[model samples]
Target: MARIAVIGAGMGAMAAAARLAVAGHRVTVYERSATYGGALGAFERDGFVFDTGPGLLHLPAVWRDLFLKTGKEPLERCVGLTEVDPASRHLFADGSAVTLPNASRAGIVSALESALGAGAGERWGDFLGRARDAWDRSRRPLLEEPLWDDWQVLGRDPYPALRQRRMLRTRQAATVTEVGALELADPRLAALFEGCALAYGLDPRRAPASAALLPYMEQTFGSWYVAGGMRELARAVYERCLARKVEFGFGSEVTSIVVRDGRAAGVELAGGAVAEADHVVAGADTALAAGQELWEDGDVRPQGGPDAGQLPGRFAVLLGLSGARPASAVHRSVVHSPDTGAEAAAVFGGRLAERPTVTVLRPDDPRIRPDDAHEAVTLTATVTGHGGAVDWRDKALRERCAEALIDAAGTAVEDLRARALWHEILTPAETGAVPAPSLAGLGGRYLHPANSTRLPGLHLVGGHAHPGGGLAHAGMSGALVAGLIVEGADFRGSQ
Candidate 1:
């Protein structure tokens, strides 16, 4: 059995480690933070529990498969799954609200017809059908293939691959803003689509067409909130890894990928310690270690700034309220600002916008929260990278930016500030500088560039790689990397 070292304990790292261990490799995971779950994990503040990252759970089957592949059943280990109806409630600038339901094409059409208009539903149907087709085509080959070498897979059936490429190319033409214009008749609905772009630190005009699948996935497979908090899901995965006898080294940051003789030998930790392994899988941020400083012959290298070719960064305010608000919904409420594209463009151009799009998350999904306590809410806005000004050492600047984000979210936040039991604000700089390796944090590097260099045995497995970020895409990338490692082993055996 090969001795493998998986760097980073995020979902991708843990998933990769579990798969490797179950495949008969002795796997060890090294994490920089004191805890596990990387971006999918949580932390506690005051009496309230805050998910440091990833609040909603969608495409859970990918997670289920990860555990099951390692000989543990996800269903048996955690609370039974609960489907969230009306996937999300969107509030537009005009104050109109629309709730997307969990249903079939016919059901979605009927609902849209009633909410928007007769022809609105048909437009939605056509849009969703095309989106679903794109998903179906890309899910297996693109999402589930090692993005670094996806050309090999695409070469298998060139025609279909070419067709898929054509779809992607055209989809790029209708930026998120363009999609909003073409897809929705109601100004409120258009803003709702733009709000989705803001949720991920993207401008509606630049956001990929593939992102349309997010709403589709939520509506089809359903969104879920783990009981207690989203952290439960992370805890469950960690326990599964433990059960499989995977060793972990928390508070141990990997400093570099140590390659000897053109192959991955192991990794060097932050404190001059070297951990040797036959194979190394990097769950950490690839961009952090891909430059000339880390590996001399790495496959993926940084071509520009931290956000090069990546989605935008975000600033957030987490509020622990003393009382609940009626307007707050079960899952998420997105409020789109006017001129979302211009707002996003300004951020990307290194100027903070006067008005930013807002996305709010409530921890008290009635199914998860009990009847007596006040709810916890997180309000976030997209921000421009202040050229590494995110260092928390600049306390006053951080506070000012945090307040600005809260102000941008408007009156709901005014109520929050008045009654909030506890409040914590995080900027992209702060979130990006969480003591973990640069790229490992939630807002680390954005989507890596195509044709970039890659580390020897170290593979990029998260939103930082191709096909871009999001829970489903990240999980799929992890699965692809795991499969590649397994296949490589088989190839070695044949030799």
Candidate 2:
């Protein structure tokens, strides 16, 4: 069996390590932090806990498959998986509200109709049909398979075009913004559609019409929450790795991927000790890996897209409330910005939004808090990542944003600020992690780098690699990398 040295203990890296270990390869993981999970992290104090990264997961089948393939225990047994019904409650600028059912198309349509107006349900349902077409057309090429060598083929827009009514008129909705304006035809609905893309750090106006698939995927697959917190899911994956006898080196930072004779030899740790291996898998950011001389000149590069500096970052607030968990509280709520256009411009323009859109998560799960008398609330927004445009370190600035979010929460949590016993803030500065590149336009440019690098035994996996970010996509990245390394470059995809 080949010896494999994997960098970083992120979910994707750990997932790959677990699979490779189960496949009989000797695997060792080197983590810079003392713990695993990377962004799948959590914060706790005074017995109240809050998720530091993504609060909900979509397309759980990815990790479910990971668990099934790597061990006898199913994912459901490893962690308490709960479907978050009424997946999300949206509070629009017009004082309108809607509760969308989990993965139920009909229920979502009915809710939209009841809240928005007559015929609104039909419009959304019809839009979902178009979105489904996009999803079906691009699902395999974009997610299931390793990125093609000639990835340009995947760039072609998969969104089916609407038949033009006027003679000789051939204009088509090419961007998500166009899809919203031409198809949805309501500002509130447009906000709802764009909000989904924004949640993924995508700019709807620039993102291809295929991005409609974002909402489609969520509405179809349903969003789920672990009973305790998302951290438990990571913990379970880490435990799976341990069960497979995969050795872990915590607080061990890798300085570079050692290369010899045009192939991956192993990794060089910060302390100068070298772990020689037949292959190296990088679960960290591609740019950082490259900077460490993991890939030589002309080895490989991303197809196209803006620099990492242009990507948006996440800013968050963790509130420790001094009140009983409200019985009627929904799992998640989104307060759409009053002016989405302005907010989008600020985020994509690398400026902080004066009134940013906010997503509030108040899990009813008891494990996140000390007792029945306290609630742990998490508030997050996608903002400018580079250039220090948003000073998260400024206590006054974080407080101002927190106050605004509390106001936006409205009835979601009655008198949110008044119930706060303590609060914590996490900025991109603190996270200090690279944002995943956006999948913009139909051009192949947005496609992340492939798993197989020019180096013979070096592989890339994680949010920064092919198929891109989010919990499910990162897991998919790991599967793709492991498949490529185990089944050879000719491997089509996971079974």
Candidate 3:
């Protein structure tokens, strides 16, 4: 059995620790914050609970698989899953709105057809079918298995093996902008699709085609809300880790990964206490880890094209309301500005725009929100730049930007302000201070092609890697990294 150390206690880290422990490795997790869930955590004030991150859960089968592998069933631990009707409500600038049904490809197509045109439904169906194909092909080899090091389990040339297994080629998937342009018949509808890409702090044009599978996953498998809040999922995962005897060190910030003799020895805490281990898995922000230059030989640098360092920071604003909006759906609601595409380009590509696209999530589902007296709302907007001296602390500028976002959402936000029991605005700078920086630049490296680097004995999960951000992808990333560690090969080499 290997003595393994997993850093960070976010969903990915927790999931990795549980799986490694179940596999008979002695595992311990170290978190820099007092809390365990990282972005999945929730904060409560005066009977109001707000999920600071990931308010909705999608592709629950993924979680079920993780639980099954760890000898714990997800259904048994928390509220069983419930399918959300009208998976999401899309409000366009043209004063038209459409409800996307959950898992009903035909229904969604019909809705699109009714709202857009006669052929819109069929076109969407075709697009979704392609996305499903991509998801099927990528899940096992790219998501489930490690990044190609474990030769015995993955065999040689996993990509060919995957191809033989019939996984879809990455090149074949639709780019974010392409999906927006093709799947939705209307330019306004297409703009709405582009807005979704911004959720991961990526521009539709720059985002990989493979990412189109994200919306597909939501439509096919459906988005879910755990009773009480999405944070419950984090709590349940933490419970599983505890059951597996995985030790957790909260409020313990790891300063560096100590490398000895070309191998991971362990990590040194912020105050300089060293914890030794046979193998170390860094669940922290990839950018932070890379910047520290901790790994042996390999550098945890950002990958991708020349303009990588210029990638913008991930930003959002969370709001809590006193009363529920009757028009607001139970699970998620998306309100877009007139020029969502332009707004998205500005946020992700480092351009500035006067208006920004916004998405609002309110869990009115009985299971997720038992407290009917009050409603919890999260409004997210992507922004560029690290939350440094210039951006975060500029009081006047920040307030102006925040107000602009609230105004762009239309009168619902005005109503919310009047009835709001409590609310807080979170900037990228605040998000960066979390266990694993949720914002783009501060946590991990920027989203660049050529600047990418890999380190020995350390792997990156979550928004920092190839597939980028989102709850499901991040969790799958942890599984993939662990699989790589067990298998023993470089990500590309495995393919």
How does each model score on lDDT?
Answer: 0.61, 0.82, 0.62
For all predicted structures, in order, the TM-scores are 0.81, 0.95, 0.81
Off by over 4 Å in 1: 103-107, 148-173, 183-186, 285-311, 324-328, 365-371, 386-418, 433-456, 489-495
Top lDDT model: 2
> What value does the lDDT take at residue 285 in candidate 3?
50
Estimate, for each residue in 30-126, the C-alpha lDDT of model 1 and write its tens digit. 9888988766655556556666666778778877777667774654466546666656655555555566666466777777777766687777777
Q: Give the C-alpha lDDT of model 1.
A: 0.61
Better of 1 and 2 by TM-score: 2
Per-residue lDDT over 200-231 for candidate 3, one digit per residue giving the tens place of the 0 to 100 score: 55566745555555667678788777777778
| Count of backbone clashes, every candidate in sequence | 8, 0, 27
TM for candidate 1 is 0.81
Q: Which ten contiguous residues of candidate 1 have the minimum total lDDT?
A: 433-442
Candidate 2 lDDT tens digits, 433-455: 44443353466555777788777
